[model samples]
Target: MSSPEQTTAIVDAATDPARSPRSLREAWLALAGLSAVFLFEMLDNSILNVALPTIGRELHASTTALQWVTGAYAVVFGGLMLAFGAVADRFGRRRTMLIGLALLGVASLATAFVSTAEQLIAVRAATGVAAAMTTPGSMALAFRLFGADGLRVRAITLISTVGLVGLAIGPTAGGLVLAVAPWQVLLLVNVPVAVLAMIGIRFGIAADAADELHRDPVDVAGAVLGTAAIVLALVAPTLFVDAGTGSWVPWAVTAAAVPAAVLFVLRERSARHPLLDLRLVARPLVSSGLAFKAATGLATAGLGYLVTLQLQLDWGWSPALAAVGMLPQVVVLIAGGSLVSPFVERVGLERAAAISAAAVVGGLAVYSLLGRFGYVWVALALVLVAAGMRVVGVAAGTNVLRGLPKERTTIGAALVDTASEVTSGIGIAVTGTVLAALFTGDLAASHWTARQTAEFQQAATVAGLTLTVVAALLVGWGIIRGRSAPITADDSDSSAGRDDSPGAEADAPRAAQHAG
Candidate 1:
C-alpha cells in the first residue's frame, strides 16, 4: 500500500528524465562502480583459466581438484544469484552489494595465503558467493538511476564494454603476468576493484527508500528449492563435459534437475512471498527477453568452445596461434558496444533484439555449413555471433528490467544473468557431448591420424548444426513472445493504480523523500 503522494512521486520518478542523470559523464562515479562490479565477474574466471596448470604445479593438485577450482565458483555463483536477488530486494540492494564487495575483497585476499587445492577451491567459492550478491545489483542500480530508455541503454553499454575488455584481454594478460609474477596476483587484483566499487557506490548512489523495498516475509522454502534447481542445472553441464555421454552420472544429475525445477515452481506458486513471482516472469516482455538472452548465450558459448577445439586440435595451430585466432570474437565483443545504441535507435529495441538474436543463429549456421572449408568461415561466424551477442546482451536485459516492477529490478537482472549462465553451461555440454559421441581416439594427442581428423570435422559440423537449430527456435520464440505491446513504466503493475487507504498515506511520502 502507498499514499497518493508516494504514488505521484514514484510516477514522477519514472516519467521524468530531467531528474535523472543527464549523461554517463554526469553519473560517472556510479557507473564506474557498477562497471567495476561487472569487470570482476567477467575477468575473474578468464584470468584464472590461464593459471590452472601453474596452480596445479605449485599446489600438487589432481585434475579433479583443479576442475573444482573453477567449477566451484560457477556453481556457487549461479546457485545463489536468484536467492540473493530476492534478499537484496527485501533488505537493500546497495547494502547487499557493498557487503558483497567487501566479501569479495576478503576472499580474494585469502587467495594469496592458499597452499592447498582444497583451500583455493574454498576461496573461489567465497568469491562466487560475493559475486552472486553484487552482480545483479549493478544492473538494478543502473536502471534505477536513469528514467530515459536512451540513457539506460548507453549506461549499460558503457558498463558492458568495460567488462568485455576485461574478458577479452584476461587470458593474454594472465599469460603475460604469469611470465613475470606469481599467479596470486591475478586474484589479488579484485581487492582494488572491490575497493573502487565500494567507494563509488557508497558515495554516488542514493540510499534505498522504504517504499522501494517489498515488505513481505522472505520465502525461505522457495529460495532453497530455487537454489537447488539452479545448482543442479549448472552442474549437469560440467558433468557432461567431463564424463562421456554414456556415463550414468551426468544423466542422473540431469534427471535430478527436473524434479528440483518442478518443485521450485510449485513452491513459488504457493509461497506467500515467493522468491520470484512467476506471474511477473510470465509477462510477455520478461519471458521473451530471457528467451533471447538464452539463445545468445547458447550460441556464443557453444561456438567458442567448438572453434577453440577446431583451431587447436583439428587444424594443428599452436596454443598462441589459436588464441590469436579468437581475436575476431574478442574484438567484436570489445568494440561492438558502441553499435548497440545506434542500432537500437534505428531499429527500436524489440526489433534490434530479434535481429541480433537471429544473427547469432545465422552465425551458428555459417559455422555448421562452412567452417571446415577454412579459417575465414570460422572467423565470420565468430564476428556474427559476437556482434549479435553484444547487442542482445544489453537489449534483452533492458527489456526484462523494463517489464518488471521497479522494486523487483534486481531479481529481473538476476534472471537475465541466470538464463545466460545456465544456457552457456548447456551450450558447452551440447558441443562437448556431440564431439565425444562422434569423434573417436585421443582428442588431445599431438598428432592425429587422418581418420581422427575426418571424425573431428564431422563431429564439429553435427554439433554446430545442432546448436544452430536450437538457437533459431529460441530466438524465433522470443521474437513471437516479444511482439506483445511494450510495457511502459507508468503502466507497470506497481504504478498503474493508486492505493487510497490511510495506512498507504504514510508510505507515500517516504518514497517521495528518497525519490532522487
Candidate 2:
C-alpha cells in the first residue's frame, strides 16, 4: 500500500547516497527497526501476567482494580485499533508511528513513577492507546517500504517471529525482572528501547508529506461508532457477568450490538469517507484473510492456554520452568518465520493454509500422546505448532493485501489485525472456561478430595485430542474455501500498481470516499 509519496521516498532512498544503504542491507535495517517496535510493544501484552500478584501486593489493589490495570490496556487497545488504522491512512504511517513511539516512551516513563493502582491503570491505558496506533501503522509501513510481494512476505515472516518471541518472552523476561527489580521497572525498561527504536525509524524511513491534505476528510463519525461497537462488544460480555446477574446481560449486549453495527454500516455506506470500505470487505482476499487470522488466534491461543495449564497446574512446573520447556516451540517458530515466504509464494495461499493446518493437527497428535512418552512429546508437538503458525500468519497477511490499492492497504490490514485481537480475547475466555471445567472435573474424579497428577494428565490428554479435532475441521474449511475462492490478477503480479481492471477503476471513487 505504498502511496506515491512513499514510493518516491523509497525510490529516492535507494538512489540517494544521503540516506540508507543502496543494497539489501537497507531493507534488513528497515525491517529490524520496525520489528524492534513491534517486539517491545507486543512483549508487554503477556509480561504483566506474572507481575500482577506483585503489583497487587505493593499497590494494595483490589481484584477488580488489578484486572483494570491489565484489562484497561486490552480494552483501549482493541477499541481504538481500527480508528488508528484509519488515522494512519489519513495522516502518514511513519508520522502515526512516531507519535505512537513518543507516547509509549512517555507512558512507560510515567508508569515507573505511579504510586497507586489507579495511576498504574491510567498509564497502562495510555500505553495501550499508543500500541493501537502503532500496530497496524507499523505493518502498513512495512508494506510501503517493500512493495514487492516477495519482499513483503519476507518482512511479514520476520515480524511474525518477533511477535511470537515477544509473547513467549513475556513471562520468562518478567520473571527475570521480578528477580532483581520492582514491577515498575518492567514498565521502565521500554523507555530506552523506545528511544533506540525511534532513532532506527528516523534513519530507516524517508520523510513523507502528510496525506490528509490530499485524502478525504477523516471519518470522525465512523471512528466513534466503530470504536464504541468494538469496545462494547468486547467489554460487555465479561463486565456484565456475575453469579447473581441474570442472562439479560448477553441479550442486552446483543440488542445493543445491532444498533451499533447497523449505524456503523449505514455510516460507511453513506459517508463521504467511510472508515471501512464496504466494497473491499466483499473481496475474497480481504474477507477470507480476516476469517483465517481469527481462526489462527483462536487455535493458537487456545493451545497455548491449555498447555500452560498442563505444564504448571498439572505437571507442577514453575512459570520459568515451563517457559524453558517451550524452547523447542520458540526455536521452531523462529525458523518457520524465516522460511514461510518461499513456500507461500511457490504454492497458492489456500494450499499453504492447508499445509499449516496439517502441521497443527500433527503437532496436537503428538501432544495428545504425551502421557505415554513424557515431555519429549511436548517438544515434538511444539515444533509442528511453530511451523503451522508461521505459514498461517504469513499466508493470511499476503492474501489480505494482495491486489489491494496501495493507498487503502492499511484499512485491510487493520481489519485483519482487529480480528486477531478480538479473537485473542475470545480464545482466552474459551480456553479458560474449558480448562477450568477440566480442572473441576479432575477434582471430582478424586471425589472432591486431594487431586492426583494422573487425573490432570488424563484431562490434558482430552484437551489435546479435542483441540486436534477442532483444528482439523477448521483447516479443512479453509482448504475448502481456498479451493473455491478465485485469485485476482493483482495477486499474481510482482508489483501492486496493476490497475488494468474495470473493478480497480471503480475502486478509485471508493478510495476517495474516505480514509481507510
Candidate 3:
C-alpha cells in the first residue's frame, strides 16, 4: 500500500485537472477567501467581549441578557453546522457561501438597528446561523480548491493562522472601534468585510458541486433532537443554581439531554444520510482532532476574555492599554503557526500534534499559576499559550480534513468548527457561573466585608487552577489519542486500481462511490 503522500501524488497524476493557473494563484485565491471569512466570523466572536459593558449600559441589558447575546450565537451556530454543511454540498460551495455572507451582512445591519435586548439576541442568533454556514463552507471549499493532501495541509495551516491572528488582535481591534465609533459599529463592520469576501469568492475561486450530494431525505428529526440537546446543555448553568444551591433542576435537565442525544445518535446511524454524519466522527483521526479543537478552543477563547477582564477590572488598565499588552501574544500566535507547518509534514501528523499539545498543556499550566501577578506576567503566559495553540490548531484542523473522504470534507470541517464553538460557549458560561457564585456566596456571608473580598479572591484562584488542570488533561488526551488512519480517498482509489481482476469493472464504480 502507498503512503498518504505517495497516494496523494498518484491520485493527482490520474485525473489532473487542467492547470488553469499557477499553484500560487490558486493558493492566494483560497487565502483571500479564507482570511476574509475568518476575519468576519472571529471579529464577531470577540468584538462583543470588548464592547459588552458599553452595550449593556446603552441597551439596558442585564448580565443574564448579555450572556444570551453571546450564547445565542454559539448555540445556533454550533447546532446548525451539519445542516448548512450538507446544504453546501447539495448545492454548491460558492452559491452557499455567497448566500450565507449576504444573510450575515443583513443580520449585522439589523443588529445595528435593534432597540430591545430581545431584538439584539434574535439578530445575533441569525448571525450565528450565517456564521455556521460560512466557517465550514469556507474551509471545505479551500480543501476542494487546493487538493486534499500536501496542498490542503499548508492552506489549512495558513487559514487557521490568519483566523487566530484575528482573534488574538481582536481586543485591540474592538477597542479601537469602540473608542472612535459606537457599539453598533462592531456589528456594522462585518457588512463591508462580508461583501468583499462574497465578491472575491464569486470571481476568484472556482466552484465544484458535490458529485454525490446526499439524496437521502433531509434529517429534520435528527436536527431537531441535536439542536435541543445543545440548547439544553448550553443553558443548564443558567437554568439551575450553583453547586451550593443543590438544585435538582440542573441534574434533571442534564439527564434528559443525554437521552435526547442518544436518540439523535441512534436516528443518525439508522438514517440513510443524517444531517450530521456520526459515521465520519467514528474515525479516530476525525474524533481526536475535533476533541483537540474543542478543549483547546474552549480554554483559549474563554481565557482571553478572562484576562481582559482581569486587566481592566483588577489592575485598572484602560481597554486600549490591555489591548496593547496583548499585542505581543498575537504576534507570537502568527509566528507559532508559520513555524509549525514545515514540521507537520516532516514528523507526521500525530507526533507533531502531540508535541504541540504538550507545549499547550505546559503553557496553560503556567497561566493557571502566574496569572495573578499583574498584566506583565499574564501577558508572558498568554504569549506562550497562544504559541502552543498556533501549532496544535493547524495540526488538528488539517489532519482531520486530510483523513476524510473527499465528500465528507465540508461536513467534517463544519463538525470541527461546531465542536470548537460549542465548547467555547460552554466554557464561558461555566466560568461566568463560577465567578458569580464565588462573588455572591462571599458577599452574602459577610455583608460585603473585607473578609468576603479575600474569600472571593481565594475562590477565583482555586477555580482558575481547576480549569487549567481540566484543559491540560483534555489537550493531553487529544495528543495521546491522535492517530490518523490510512483511509483517505487517494489511498482507497489507489488500492482499487491495484485490484484489477475479473470483477474489477463491476466493483470500480462501487469503490469510487464509497471513496467519495
Report the candidate with higher lDDT, 2 versus 3: 2
TM per candidate comes to 0.91, 0.80, 0.79
Error at 248, model 3, angstroms: 6.4
For each candidate in the order shown, give its overall lDDT on alpha carbons: 0.86, 0.69, 0.68
Error of 2 at 459 (Å): 7.6
Per-residue lDDT tens digits for candidate 2, residues 1-516, read 446655555456734424432223445546666887778766885888889999999999998898889888888988898888877777777777889989999999998679899999999999989888887766776766653445555667777678778877788789898999988888887788678667756666765434311287888999999988887766654553221124566447647866997899999999987888787676655566665676666666666766776677666678679888878878787666756765765564556766875776777667777633677877777787778877877777666666366666666677877887776655555544444455544432313324555555665666566656665666666656555655566544522443435454234323422211
Give the per-residue lDDT of model 1 (tens digit) for 20-73: 655556566788899999999999999999999999999999998999999999
Residues 153-253 of candidate 3: C-alpha lDDT, one tens digit per residue: 56666777767777767776888888888988888888998887886676556665345244556678887887778767665645543333366777687
The clash numbers for all candidates, in the given order, read: 2, 3, 0
The worst-scoring run of ten residues by lDDT in candidate 1 lies at 496-505
| Clash count (model 3, backbone only) | 0
Pairs in clash, predicted candidate 3: none
Ranking by TM-score: 1, 2, 3
Of 1 and 2, the candidate ranking higher by TM-score:
1
TM-score of 1: 0.91
Misplaced by over 4 Å in model 1 are 1-18, 485-516
lDDT minimum window of 10 residues, candidate 2: 507-516
